[model samples]
Target: MTQVNKALTAFQVPIIDVTTDEAIFEGEGWDAVVVIATSLAEIKQDEVSLLAAHASQIDFRVGKSATLLFAPGLAGGRLIISPVTDSDNEYSDVRIFAKAAREGIAIAKAAGATKPLLVVPSVTDNRFANAEQVAALACGQELWQPLEARESKSLQPSLTAIGLLNTATHSLLLNAAESGRVLARDLCGTEPERMSAIGFAQYCVDAFADSGLAVSVVDQVEQLKAQYPLLSAVGRSSFDVARHHPRVVKLEYVGEGPITKTLFFAGKGVVYDTGGADIKVAGSMAGMSRDKGGAAAVAGLMKALSILKPKGIKVIAELGLVRNSIGSDAFVTDEIITSHAGVRVRIGNTDAEGRLVLADLLSHLRLQAQTAVNPQLFSVATLTGHVVRAYGGYPALVENSAAKKQGVAATLAEVGQLWGEPFEVSRLRPEDFDKIADKNGAADVVSSNNGPSSITARGHQYPAAFLIKASGLTETELAFTHIDIAGSAVEGDPLYGKPTASPLVALLQFSN
Candidate 1:
């Protein structure tokens, strides 16, 4: 692999190490210079004296809102002056500054500059450092340009901190950027086959083979069918050896000594959803390749855990890898399929295949928790369009424990604020399950209801309710939370809708 490929696959950000002693305009020239200021007045002073020298040559003005100024810097280099705060606030928030810095990088890239210098005028506090680091990472992401057949170049840029730059803060920025790069690549890639169920599983195995992670693969249809009928049922349609078979990938991260608490993470890995036998319309299935976003997120979280390696907590990530394709043997609606939990499920809509796969895997996790100590189960998936309609790019969080709901909500909010991955808390009412019970009177559970309307109208609560029941988790034994990232899985844009790879930072923060 080339250097660019290595940097991308290994999740390393393109950053060049630098010392504080280096002059801003010395040695090799830079393509652009990013100047961060609080106000235009601040820029006229000694804080940005370097840029102030050429302020008259280039029209520079300050405003109430964050703005960017483009001009010529020393030695024909471009200068980008970005303000983080307006007149109302003294210091801009980390997010605001980070965004401004990102915009600065975008402007520089648009102006045909590859090597840009980032200069923050603020005192290096925790907030300032965070914003600066986020800016650096965002800049690196903007610089990264990948191609399928041709060799790509690495995005290596130098960062200079005017004030004291802590070593720990720098390291944190580098780590976060690396993780973000992994997520961006997965979300932004255009290749569908590379992210297929089997293909993804192999990728995971390759990623963690030497990372001290115990990886297991279950690909044979018969073997999966014998163990997890629901998972096998959803994946049985595309069983061709040449076309890529359905599979389940399990990653276990056991800390030192006996496991005291087990955190189970199950993700829906429907590589491409043709809605099975139900068959989705043209536009509905346009980005169906992103169906495996849930699994991708789980994989991203696993990658973070491998590096962080928090002590005492054992993490098990189960990815339900499958392709919900339509074929002669595809599982259809109204079929009575028995789940691994032994609950008889009458499929109401084959389109609701994510829940079916998650149901079996969650049930298996519940069974494993029986012997484990302090087990907590958390499942992530883009299970419903209703969630997307309701939350619109923010994950919908549903937890079984009503009492701990507030705490969970606060934690999620904190993580969101810290990392920009926000989620809303949604309730799972009893009536949701009652409707499912009414539909499948003969069976223990109904995979879905009469139509998409019933599922969407209820805000996708039915699936969560069914999953709880299928997982064999009693209301009283509340230790589970379901994150519905249906709407939030991939960012909607005119170009390819990129996967957000959300809640990865949240999980990492919570684990720590």
Candidate 2:
């Protein structure tokens, strides 16, 4: 059998490794050079010493200063000096290093350097050493080329760490960045078919083919109708309107030994959500392509884990790939549908299709866990705009157990401080579940209640409750957490309000 390569060829961070003895400035062909200093003495002795002629031109006292100087005799080459404080020595504090790297890359780009060099003087400190590579990866942001056939103008820069370079640390940083690059490309790229439900499943299957993962894809509605009616209903709507089919992609990673715990991750993969028969306004449907951010994240996590090969814990991912488009065949408001878990659901609004897809996927996962020894569930989705309104640019986390919730919250908080991807914890109250109950003898429960009495502002919780019920697990029986990444998945910037592929760093850190 021919093996499929899951490795990404586009949007990769090009890293050039250099030994300590190599003089970074020896090459006359270089466009620019970046020198990072930890102390004032190092700023004067180590960094500034290389450019003694222009030492007097720069004020080296300020921390985090990026000074661009021209070398007169060296054919007008540019040199950038960035300073760091002693307090920023915490290796665990990724922000300090990432910030310094971002500054270095910005300065290099401004100097018109297609291939600049980064030099960190104090490499004995692991933080400084890691910072060099972090800067190189951050420089990737400048060199990033989206999925376009057009030629890219981005540059691939090199770096040199003065102290002993930890090869393992360098590999880890590069791997993490590579994983992130795949996500960014998937989220930000403009491939409508590739981002579609069926296309996304194909992407996952190709990606994990050679990664030792067991992949299964259910693409037709007929195959899923009896077992996953909710998912089938949502996906069938897009068949006539968008000519897109839905699919459920499952990936499993099992270790050699007796697996003690199984981790199941479900991502809502509504490739293009047009709010079905209810329909979304122009503004609401403008960026509907990003509705698959949750599945993109899951694919990214599985990619990283496949490379990292974490032991003992088996990982399973269920990506529910479907499109909710409006047409005569689309599921509409006030329609009743029986889910795979045997729960009768009334479609209060067709826009609430993400939870419906997840409901069936989670139900399947619950059944899988019955045979497995110990199982923990996690669901990620861009469920509602209410979460974006409440948290602005942060993900809302809802966990069944308070203790487990606090632990994950604390871990995520620490990771957030370092990575700048914060998540807020939302309560999964009993009233939330009570509201989803068959109130008017209409159905087992309403899929969504966007009416006046409905808790629309706290809409993130309602879906969480509905999913828990769909999973066929009591809140106390299984450990489950829901992550609503509606706001954090995309950038808030006006000009580039694109998908950011967030929480990848946080999730990777938590898994570690």
Best by TM-score: 1
Stretch of 10 with least lDDT, candidate 2? 157-166
TM-score of each: 0.83, 0.82
Local lDDT at 322 for model 2: 84
Q: Residue 413 lDDT in model 2?
A: 62
Task: Kindly report which residue pairs in candidate 2 clash with one another.
Answer: none
Which has the greatest lDDT?
2
The TM-score between candidate 1 and the true structure equals: 0.83
In candidate 1, which residue ranges exceed 4 Å CA deviation? 1-12, 15-25, 28-32, 36-76, 85-95, 111-115, 119-130, 140-168, 180-184, 187-190, 240-242, 255-261, 402-406, 453-455, 475-478
lDDT of every model, 2 decimals: 0.66, 0.67
Estimate the Cα RMSD of every predicted model relative to the unseen true structure: 4.5, 4.7
Residues 1-512, candidate 2: write the lDDT tens digits.
22213235433544555454233343544456566656435543343455633464465433447667765433126666665545444434444555566676677666676566565555555334345555555555445444433224442222221121223345554555555556544643445565677667766777666778888998656788888899888977676644488888898887667777787889888888788877777575777777888888877777777777766778888988888877778877788898888888888878888999998988888788767767778888888778877777779888776426446556666665555456788877888888788778878788888552124756787788888876565534667788898887766452235455666766766665
Q: Total clashing residue pairs per candidate?
A: 0, 0
